[model samples]
Target: MPNKLVIYIHSGEPTQFSFAIVNGQNQLQNIHHHHDLLPQESFEEIIVIVPTEDILLTSVALPKMSRNRYQSALPFALEEQVIDDVEHLHFTAFDYQPDGQLPVAIVAHEKMAIWLQALDALSLKPTQMLPSVFALPYNEGQLQIIVESNILVRTGRWAGFASDRINFSQFLHALPVGSAPQEIEVLNFSDTSLAASQDSLFTYHEKFAASADFFPTLVQHALNSPGNLLQGPYAMKKTTLWRGDKLLKISLCLGVALFSLLFLYPTVSYFILKPKLTALNAGIKRIYQKQFPKSTAIVAPKLRLEEKLKKLAGGGDKGGLNQILSHLGQAMQTESNVKLKRFDFQNGQATIELTADSSEDFSTFTSALTNQGMLVKQQSANLVGTKINATIQVS
Candidate 1:
């Protein structure tokens, strides 16, 4: 909602220009021209619209050059040619499309942008630079009339059509005013000579004005319209324009990273230190068992030992003593003459007392256990009167 100035530079003459000051409402406040007198100090800011070719074509043709070359070529060329030119001009460019055919480039130069930065360094307010076309309403029903350096084109709906139609560049040559019309009025051109053939009967009315609020209306229309892909250099300048404060995009990114670290710290610590914690817990239990060996139940001691080893080595779940006893019973059951009397598991060893028909049965049991990766040590094997008592150590 700030006052904006639309300054038009004469084609080829960078210094000689005409400016029209308009308010937030798009109402013209003042219009003036300066030719011989150079601006002593830069105005709030300046927006230069330079004519250039499409960036896509430039990229396709000049593939070896940087992408910026497509946009920078015009300004670079201008700065090289013009003497005593404003050295601090900030600008961008876009292709200007007339009648929706081919696009010519338009660049905007902003002296005000540089001036404002200087002021900001000394703690002062800076002037804002807005697009000249942005001030006009964007409604297709509401005419978007542009009066630029003796050129007048009306863009609006005709018949049932609902789009911007730029049909007239002829009015630019028809003006016979002093020099040429530097500042043109934006109004409905439905009644103007530039209207479509079907609306040729419409008559010009001086009282016709825009139908809606200028800024918001245009903003909405622009949002809805099939916008130009190649923005002139002025568009580029506007992107880099000072908006009073330094952007903190990097700081925001750092903050997000820090927040993520806060959430991830516990999970990472748990995974990294889990084995050490388990080993520590197992060592503590082993120390407890050693201190009070008699007080601990015999079954509880072995279970605790298994748990400690599993925790320390990060091993899978181990079967209980019952499962091992059942496996031994099944192995012994395979021999019909072996009558299992007693079985014991102590210090990683299994002891068995059985009444076997012969010594050969004891040999077969030992061979089966040995084949299953058990380290067997024969403690005693007495085969007397068809009874065998065998004690073995399985490490």
Candidate 2:
């Protein structure tokens, strides 16, 4: 569990602030009175409670619409109720009521800018910024009022208003008959008691003692309240994880892959390819021994074979068609999957079509012919149904 710091800014005074630190268990750890200085203590969450007078709490009726459309249409919906132009106000909508009306908080764009700038100067980023009137505890069927320098009222779960103390009576009269709460509970924090009212709006009026520590109690109530004004552009950026358990897991996977390539891959390749290499060398030795039966010590089979072929060709550049054909057949004897499809001899070149099980077999056959001093020109190689069909011209 993490501790949270709640800071409440005094109305009309940006420099003077009161703050409280609440532990994870909702117990008050410390409280500070009006201080011009900001606290240097770190907390997991910081909540800023701004003056309610700067925020207007009202409900607007809106039909079902997309989220983006709802946001764009909100200011126009309550345009007539506000004296300022719609573009100058920042509106944040809360949850819907049972009566199908959406509660919204409206404040001037300039006021929001000022509050953010103040917090920025103090290096305090609030996770949740709310209107202070919402800090008053709300009860069903009752209007909770806190009488301090101003009258803060909480009428519903998401409904509230701040009014001047001298105009509290007029504000009550302005509300429609059925709209007023059934009962009124006042928590007087001021040095003087609330003035008695003769209006019928105060029929079920009652008074309760204010919390011993007013600002901290205000923060405690706000800890559970839902609405936060930091929506859309004002929202706090979430932290990203560059190093953690997830990254460690990824690093371990890469290490295993590297180990497989460096240690396991070559070992597996040696076992698979060793037999093929040995067979090729033995085939070359057999061909060399067949040509030079009386001669021994076949040091380089490919070079010796080429020398013998050149001597048989009268040391000319072109081997005869018969010799070329015979040499091609002997060279391809080791490649079991390679087959001679067709052949056409013209001038001194033999144009032969061959088919092999794979491109690798074709490459081996071509490499062997080229090493034996044959001028092999591969014209085309195409794959057809699990076989490589190729054409080669040799002289």
Cα RMSD (angstroms) for every candidate in the order listed: 15.8, 10.1
- C-alpha-based local distance difference test score of model 1: 0.44
* Tens-digit lDDT track of model 1 for 1-395: 55554444343353444555555565555555643233233344333321111111110112233436645554454464334352444333333334432222222234434333433453323233333343334554343454322222333221111122343433333323442333333444233432332233233233333433322333333332332322433233332434322356666778999999998999899998999999987887776567457655434655667775454334221233443454565657666777767766544445666666778887777666566555668777776776687666544
Q: Pick the candidate with the highest lDDT.
A: 2
The per-residue C-alpha lDDT of model 1 at residue 327 equals 52
Against the unseen true structure, what C-alpha lDDT does each candidate score?
0.44, 0.81
TM-score of each: 0.35, 0.59
Q: Per-residue lDDT of 1-395 in model 2, one digit per residue for the tens?
A: 76888888889986667878899888888887643443565677888999988988888999877767888999889999999999999999888777889899999999889888888887877889999988889777677888777888777788878888678777777776766765566777767666464356455444545555678669879889888999877888653333466678899999999998999888999999999999988988887787888877777777887776555555344567667877797778867789999987656688999999998898889888887788899899899988999999998
Stretches of candidate 2 above 4 Å error? 34-39, 195-201, 204-212, 240-395
Model 2 vs. true fold: TM: 0.59
